[model samples]
Target chain A: MPQIAQLAATYSSQIFWMLLTFGFVFFVIGLGMVPKVQSTVDARDKKIADDLDAAKASSAAADALEADWRAKENAARSDAQARLAAAKADAAKDREARLAAADAAIGEKLAAAEAQIEAGRGKALGEIEAVAAEAATDIVRRLAGAEVSSDAALQAVKAVI
Target chain B: MHQFTIEPMFGTDHWAIGGYNIAFTNSAMWMVLAAVVIWAFVALGMKRQLVPGRWQMAVETMTGFIDNLLSANVGPEGKKFVPYVFSLFMFILCANLLGLLPLGVIGSHAFTFTSHFTATGVLAILSFSIVLIVGFARHGFHFFSLFVPHGTPGWLLWLIPVIELVSFLVRPFSLGLRLFVAMMAGHILLEVLSSFVINSANAGPGWGLMIGVPSFLLMIGISALELLVAVIQAYVFALLTSLYINDAVNLH
Candidate 1:
């Protein structure tokens, strides 16, 4: 056909150039750019996931530390309460012993005064009764919350000496 | 005066190139003249300036024109083809300008050129062939398939192939026809006009000379117009080829 002949006449050079151009593009894209693009995308996705995982783990650790601090605070509060209770009990026992010792000393002084009054047959017995009575009065005054003390009266006697 | 002659350069006893019934023609001279003009313009533009003269400015137009054209139409990736396009523009431009010269007529021994039908026809084909080859290589056999657009109904599938074949068939025809017609028309016009001018000059006296001057001026004007046409036709031929290739290699 004349058309065929004309086409051939027109396109001979084009046929040659096309074959070379196609081969070059195939070699460049199939072997080079495509594979590189795929691997780079995969690497990027993996990196993102890894960063997210690391972030999650760190946040979890922070939560755990917060929980631990709350638990330790509760333990310290209970321990302080236990120490305070023991101190209050010790103070109460010390106060009761001091009160009992004061009562025993006062009772012993009254009994000694009565024995001196019954056994003596002179003024010494009367003086002993006076001393017992004074000691009982001072003890009653001390028990009733007066500021006067037996040491102040003794200080005056010592000053005369 | 320069010697001009076309003493049968090729043929089987006088036709064709390298071998066949083709004769050497003046078009070849014009082609050379075009080359020199382009070279001289480029040389002129490159010299003397931080600021370019008009000659240099004209030469530099190619660099900017093709650069912008390719980048805008095909994206910056296609800018690589600028040199080929620029050269194509220059060659045709030179050929058209040379067609205007009266150096190669029969009356003038200093310059005369004539082309056999085969020579003129073949030269036009040669330029088209370059475009076709480059495009096909750029896209491959896929280039041939470019005629058929994707997404047609199954019932219409048969028509697609026929349409594609017909479209494929028109490429070489259109490309060759445009250049051949333009060149043929220019030569025929120049030949007919020159004949009239010669005969008219002998027909009268002072009036004959006076009429001849205007006729000569018309020829000169046509010659300049032909120069512009030559470059433009070459560009259209090349650009259409690029568009065809773009269709083949890229869908958009």
Candidate 2:
């Protein structure tokens, strides 16, 4: 009963101080501490996000560089292979030209050797015919003791020899 | 037993306004002390780190717990009331624990303001007033519909509103009473048990050990429980405030 009874007189003073304190706490804490703490948290989170983004970007750049290098290496290899194949084809062409020229020179030499042999054989056969005609005229005069013409003897020897 | 008395901390002939006992009494001084202590606690604990330390973790946990309670009860709009609820919870919590200190009760110095109905009642009234003002402001005349239950018989509707009105009016008393009674009862129990331990120990050495041990153990257990009660009462005060505000905003 005294508790209820005292409340009438006591409430005003209690309330005045209560209001002052409670209001002080509300304004100071709500406006002051809450926002400060929140900003710190947000700043920390932002830094983390920025670091993560940078890491991802650098990794992607590295991957792209590796890919470009591989492509360049492949291109250079193909270029070397093409040059090698062209050199091989040129060498084959040069060898075939040299062989054809050698074949033509051998054919010309064979024809010249056959022509000289034919001329020498013709001269030797003419001398042999003249000797045979002389011999034939002498043999006819000795065997029959009859006079035979040199021109007729030579003609007969040319026909037989 | 004498610890619950209200007396002026300083001389009687000091500051008084208009014959009112505005003299800085034990109650008012403790209220200020509690405020200062809480202020130091939260203000100093505001050191922000990505991974919180012990003090920051405690502060953040308390704030986050209150925030979750508000969101659950009052939805997002309750966020605006965080400072008020924070002040109320911390102030009451500090006051309750300060009263349990080793300070003598001759002047009732450091008496918990929450143990007095006047202080707790003011908080209840403030919360109730917000509920009324917000309910009416948001819903206009339709706020009266709060007492009207849905799917009632037309004849019984009149009786239901009367009951509802009484129930609604009882909220402030119940809110204040719950905090005051819990704190006062816990302190009274501790006082009684501690006195018992002292009295038994003085009876005789042999009998003192027989009875005093149990009494001392009980007192220790009760003190631990009281500590738990202190935290719980603060939580309940804020939770009820949020619930009332929730009803005002969301209806039902």
Put down candidate 1 lDDT per residue, B1-252, tens digits, no spaces: 122223322332233334322333333434344455655655555543434567645655655665556566666555555555555544444444455456565564222111122222343454456546765777677665565677767898779878977876677666666665676677667666776688788887675687777778888888887767766776776576556545544644
lDDT of each: 0.54, 0.80
Q: Report fnat for all candidates as fractions from 0 to 1.
A: 0.00, 0.40
Question: Any idea what lDDT model 2 has?
Answer: 0.80
- Compute the lDDT of residue B68 as modeled in candidate 2: 76
Residue clash pairs of candidate 2: none
Among all windows of 10 consecutive residues in model 1 chain B, the one with the lowest summed lDDT is B110-119
lDDT for A51 (candidate 1): 86
